[model samples]
Target: MMQCYGKSRVLTPTVVAAAAFALNKNRSLRTQSEEVGALDSWKKLWDTGMTRWHQRDVYWVLQKYGDDYIHKESRVLVPLCGKTVDLAYLTTKAKEVIGVEGVLQAVKEFMQENPNLQMEAVGSRNGFDCFRGEKIWLLCGNFFHFGPAVAGKFDVIWDRAAMVAINPSDREEYVQVLGSVLKPGGVLLLSGYVRPKGDVKSGPPFTLNKDQVLHLFEHQPWVASVECIESVNDAFSNEAWYKRLILRWRFGGVVSEDIWAIHSKAK
Candidate 1:
């Protein structure tokens, strides 16, 4: 991602290499023109699409979990939250909710929509300002920056679309960060799409099968038990598709770990 830090834009090594490859598309301007087009496409379409998707609601998860999810005033953490409706869910049950987002556009829109929310930009290490209200706050920064010092702490971490949104190569990092941010006995209501548009070989809409999803959190010692809630079947282009897995991880993983959601429920 090309990020604007100070006066100039900083490109991660992956971004730079990707840009190089994109530039080689056309014989005329070749790689250079391709890179510009690719980046423009990402900013205009792909990234914007992500922001919009997250901004929608999470009523599906809420209906499933119901009130047992948490009580009023419980603190919750939403990582790479984007401009999501889950914040609304959090505010109702929890006293405060902290949301993290990398893109600037999404955060800006969120702040505007929730005008009652107060914001104070933080220093470099923690990323953006603190948007404080009776129940909402957003730390518009990278997902990896959760942990104790930055976010203080939280009793629940809701990870709906975040894990799959990350590159497969970065799954471990994502798990490590989640473990660090969540409390020892905290709960994680995780949800994500699977078998999403098979053509999505390159994406933020990456999908994961049951085996792969389990593998992500298995190595982490802090997580207790990983259990599946449900699977959503979706249809795309006349192809029957499997979209999501709703999971629960408790006390870092609950002592009597019971997993294997797909084998038991998914057909």
Candidate 2:
């Protein structure tokens, strides 16, 4: 059964039991060899059409929570964005939406898929191909190389798959990079997956519990507060693609989808 927990509630036993089952089953799944943070690996995924993470429409989390932070004057940044239709949706609410992607293939696909957007090649910067639309800019290059200097600070950041897609060791650096581009008082809407207490390690879509997220941002001077707004236990049940991936990977265990609202301290 699907369960959604609010900020005031603690994790239930059902969630824990499901996670245990998932981790035990995942232990038998095939080991993944791809380096998740490597640009080449992402390029290969785009080349081979292995992007199961790509959703056709705006993500539900964004649809439900976006209006609270996004406004007509807001400048939003989306990291590790992979041809998501959400970028187009964000432009409707914000003044400008900038997406940083490592793979040119993915960026090209986004442009191709949204012809009505009318994006044009603006040129290149720091080896990144830049595409400009009415209220959107796609930067095709290394996400780590992007900073506030490249495009100024953003009022909001939408991180749906960026955090979980990288290695755990790189989390601190990821947080630092995110902090560098966010304006004071800006908000980050992060969506991630969490499993029960276990050591099963295969990933591109890694597990990151609420505690880990808090610890990562706790010591950061720019951070004001980190709050878990929602948690859904049966996160992928309704998505046929997620089910197919789970079956193909022999993954067992309850994975919960968590939404975090991380706020930057005001200046």
lDDT of each: 0.55, 0.78
The best candidate by lDDT is 2
Q: Candidate 1: global Cα-lDDT?
A: 0.55
Estimate, for each residue in 143-184, the C-alpha lDDT of model 2 and write its tens digit.
756776678899999999899898777677678778888898
**lDDT by residue for model 1 (1-267), tens:** 121112211112222221231111122322455435533543475354633344344545665564666677567888877677678667877778888876666676777776655554544445455655656777755555455777676777777667767667767756666666666567777765555334325455566555566676543455455556555443121221211222112111111111121111111
**What shift in Å separates residue 64 of candidate 2 from its native position after superposition?**
0.6
lDDT, model 2: 0.78
- Listed in order, each prediction's TM-score against the native is 0.66, 0.84
Candidate 2, which ten residues in sequence have the lowest lDDT sum?
21-30
